[model samples]
Target: MSLTLAARTQHMTSSAIREILKLTERPGVLSLAGGLPSPDSFPLDALAQASERVWRTQGAQAMQYANSEGLMPLRDWIARRVSLPHWQVEPEQVLVTTGSQQGLDLLGKVLLDPGSEVLVEQPTYLGALQAFSAYEPAYRPWLADAQGPDPQALQPRNAMNESVRAAYLVPSFQNPTGHAIDADRRAAIAAALRAHRVTLIEDNPYGELWYDAPPPAPIAASAPHQTVYLGSLSKVLAPGLRIGYVVTPPDEAPGALALRARLLQAKQASDLHTPGFNQRLVLQLLADGFDLDAHVVSVRQRYKAQRDAMAQALTRHLPEGCIWQIPQGGMFFWVQGPDGFDAAASLPDAVEQGVAYVPGSAFYVDATLASRQQMRLSFVTLSVAQIHDAVVRLAEHLRREGRRSC
Candidate 1:
């Protein structure tokens, strides 16, 4: 018998990065495609010890089902850690999710409706687009530049046109583009959101991965009442643990109570709760003085060197007129090839030459705005030597393709 599918299935699409990763798995292919954190950065020893302690000390309880809102201690830790001088987060507002990806899904479930207008950057995180698309919201491109999204777009066209349900941003070391919004621009964006009375979803998974310096205080700090903040330990701690949290608006904020309730209900429906053993393992690590801050510092230093290597290689090997910037932090570099280049079309040849990267067009919500010449190259996963080699292969592919274009 034939089976019927839900209408939402039409909006769902496979992740371009995940699909590319499968091809990059071929023998001898050096990937600059996936934004995978280096395995070397994981605190293996500390995690092993933490896992043992959880199994030894709290074996039964850790294995059982847990609170849907997350363990209180972990939530408390998140609340204190994310709290700023001007704005403080409360434990009640923190909802620990299986991963920040789950937080995105939960928010989309509660906040979006069919045809709801949602503002997204021209080239935002593809994963966010994937998560939110399931809820079937109409996407409007939030025009941006090197600085960040334009504040003027936040303004409503007329008083009656306040139909924009929410705006999503990755203010610190944004995925795909590696663009970080400066402090002044963040404040301006916050002001616009406040004035327009629009809700903001601020996803900040790479805030602590900064190489030069920590990114500016979160945009949520400036407009706490109008923003839903999502943070994750995957980048800083361990992704396998799948630990992440969402900070909802304060009680006094409009619709705060109802929004939080729906989010909690959505969480319950999704997975009942994140793994209790993982939560306990994190607490055990902290209690044992794992020194996460120090670990993150070391991670930053190692990634910075890798970033430098990628920068040097790109400069030396890429064709003239190809453009990219030295990112201050994060895993990937967004590079635009010279005129007459098509990054997506060149991927098969690049992979055949033993290198791979993600075409930047996958990140755009609107096909017309997507650039055919751009690709995202990840630097954190490969060693310095491998990075240089990968760039050489990629540059050779570009040159060979350019000869054909001429």
Candidate 2:
């Protein structure tokens, strides 16, 4: 007998990045494909101490089931940590999620309907597309330039008469592309969203990972009532813990109360709640006076050095006509190989040469329209020496492809 699946299953697809990741696991392959933070940055000893304290003091409470809204103290901490001077986030509006990915899924469940129009960057976060796709929304690619996604696209214009349910953005050190929206553009985006009364989903997993200076205040600061902000500790802390949060708009905002209630119901239906043990563990660490600010500073220094190494290697080894900009922060370097290069088709050869990178097409909503020459290379996980070696292998692969085309 054959089992029938839901219609939505047709839209569900495995992440191309993950599929490529499996290929890179072969021995001796130096992968530049994953957005993995360096293990050295994790405060192992501090976490160990915190774990012991939690087990000794509140093991039973930690093991027991938690409320759907998450631990109150942890929620309070998140609210305070993310709250800006202009935009104040309250604990009551916070929903702790398994990860920011779940926040995306939950938002998709509560906000999107089949055929709903959702604005997205031309090449946005692939995981988000994966999550939103399950809801079967019609994606409208937002116009963008070198500064990042254009704000004017948020306005309703020719051929776009339907109301946009929501617009998703990664304004700070976005995935696949290391572009960050500058201050002026962010303010303009906020204004456009407010003027058009469009809801904004701002996912900021890498805002705290800056090297030179912090990014501008989130667009939410200016339009707090119109934005649902998602944050994650995966990049700055350990991803294994899977701690992330969703900050809903203020209760006073339009439909904010109903939105919050529906999101909580979605969370309850998704998983009774995120693990209580992980929430307590994070609280325990904070209670122990772990200086997160100082820890973040240290991480920035290490990653900046790695970024520099990757920049130098690319400049020295890449074939003529290859293009990339040294990212100010974040893990990946978005690279475009010379004309006639097909990054997707060249992956097997690159992996064979002992290096691997994610093809840029994977990040675009319409892969058919994506640039064949672009690829994303992550620099955070590897050492300076390993970075150089990976670049050498990738450059060799590109040069070989170029010669073959000639």
Candidate 3:
């Protein structure tokens, strides 16, 4: 007899970016694919000191199994860091997860019912779509103009007969797109969510990594009762720690509590708890006067230089009609090619020429959008010199393919 798997498992596919990253491992290939922070920016000495302190001071506690709700001090720190005047979150309202990705999975399990309608950006975060898809939500595309996503798209419409149970937004330096919703749009989205009584999941892993001015206040600040704010230490501190927190609404409606409870249950099932040692280590670091703001300033300088390099490379190399926005923050640059060129179709050629990028279609909800001529390039991983050479090679490849004229 043949082995069988769940029906839901059948539709899932491997991440295209992961596959391309593998190809990029070939010696001499310049990869603009992975969303990786510079290794040089990590506070290795500080982390080592924190880890040592954790073992020496809290050794027993670090090794023991802890509560599913997470370490109290860590939760307290997160609550303090993320709180706003409009949304004063308490430690109890925070649920710690292995990473923000786990938060996404737990939210999907708790809130999404099969076939329920959820609104998402036209090209949303692929990882989010993957996390939510396991629960089988019917994704309704949220429309966007140059300014960013319009909140009206989530409104309950007589024409579509759809009521959005929830809408997910990155709001600040969104993945793949690297575009943030402006302040006005943030308020509009919050108002719409409140008016329609829809839940909002605000995932903000990259908010603190801004190179220029900070993005707008979170949508949660505007509609605290209706938003679930997810924050992470991955980009700012270290991803290996896998520490993230969720700030549920202040009202703590039955739905919100139920979702939190279910998510905690899911956490218990997944890992019994986020590792105790890591939590204590982070807490120790915070207590030790590790200035996150100053550290991030250094990080911002490195990334800003990279962003500038990528922008200049694109301007000098890319063919006419190709366009991209120079993001003020975040790690990605979303590029759109000429109308008839598909990034995926051109990937083999790009790789052969010693450069790699993620096809934009990987980030889209609809498979038809895969054919659209777009790509997401990461400015964080490659050196400035390599980015310039890669862009020249990529432009040459595109011209050879007749997709563009040099």
Candidate 4:
């Protein structure tokens, strides 16, 4: 017998980053591919205490099914934590998701139709591309300047007559680029979106992971009625909890409400709700004064040292013409190899030297063979000493490749 599948599945592909990660799982490779937080940074002991407290107090309530909107107190806490002095958010507008990733999938379900135009950065987040691809939207590459993505890219120009449904951006400490837009450019982008009446999905999981300084206010605060803001506990706390929240528009536009209803329906259809035990455990931690700010401060210090080590190692080992800019915050560094040097083609040689890194082409929605000269190296997972050795191995491989080119 033959089986049939939905047409939408045709465009879907396994995550390239994840596929590469599997290759790096060898015993001796020092992988700088995954954007994972250091295990040393997790508050495991505090979480254990919180779990014990939650089981004692909530007991059976923690095991039962929950409202699709998520735990009320958690929503309220998220609102309070993310809001600014000028920008206020109501708890009613918050929708807790399994993770910010699921939030992206739901947005794709409700906001996109086949052939809908969506604008994205030239080298955008791969996961977002994968999540939205199933909806079959036509993607327009947003132009970028030295600062970041250009706001003018969203305007209705005669060259591109298509109407954009939404533009997705990771403004702070972006995934592969590690570039943050300044406050002025953010305001410009908000104005452009408001002018075009286009919706903006601002994904900001790394905003709180800054090292030297705090990132600018969310663009959602600038244009509350036109933006959907996504936040997560993954970077600052732990990703295993899978707790993330979405702040919907204040006006609760028809589209916003409809989307929320559908998202809740989708959540119920998928998992019935995020694990209630984890929700209660998180709440208990917040209620018991877990000192999240203090925890973040400690994590920031550790990451700063790691970032410094990576910067120093890069200067010591990388071949001529290789370039990278040290990020003020965030986990990864975007590195450009010498002209015509393809990181993908050279991966075997790098691995033979006991080092591993992700080729940058994987991050683009419509990547090409010509884009293989760039790569992304994550500095958060490895210790300072290990990072030094990894860079040395990578440098040795690059030197060998450079001689072949010569």
For this target, which candidate reaches the highest TM-score against the unseen true structure?
1
**Each model's TM-score, in the order given?**
0.99, 0.98, 0.95, 0.97
Encode model 1's per-residue lDDT on 61-144: one tens digit a residue: 999999999999999999999999998999999999999999999999999999999999989999999999999999999998
Local error of candidate 1 at 248, Å?
A: 0.4
Give the better candidate number (3 or 4) by lDDT: 4
| TM-score ranking of the models | 1, 2, 4, 3
Task: Assess the local accuracy of residue 152 in candidate 3 as a C-alpha lDDT between 0 and 100.
Answer: 80
Better of 2 and 4 by lDDT: 2
Model 4, span 116-174: residue lDDT tens: 88999878888899999999999888878987788888877666665688999999999
lDDT of each: 0.94, 0.92, 0.86, 0.87
> By the TM-score metric, which is better: model 3 or model 4?
4
Write out the backbone clash pairs for model 2: none
Runs in model 1 lying further than 4 Å from the true structure: none
Per-residue alpha-carbon lDDT of candidate 3 for residues 300-355, written as tens digits (9 for 90 to 100)? 99999989998999999987768888998999999988767778888987888888
Name the regions of candidate 2 deviating beyond 4 angstroms.
158-161
Positional deviation of residue 352's Cα in model 3 after best superposition, in angstroms: 1.4
lDDT tens string, model 2, 1-406? Answer: 9999999999898999899999989999999998889999999999999999999999999899999999999999999999888888999999999999999999999999999889999789999999999999999988788888888887776565646889999999999788889999999999998998999999999998887778999999998989999999888889988889999999899999999999999999999899999999999999999999899999999999999999999999999999999888888899999988999998998899999999999888876669999999999989999999999999999999999888
Winning candidate number (lDDT): 1
Q: What TM-score quantifies how close candidate 3 is to the native fold?
A: 0.95
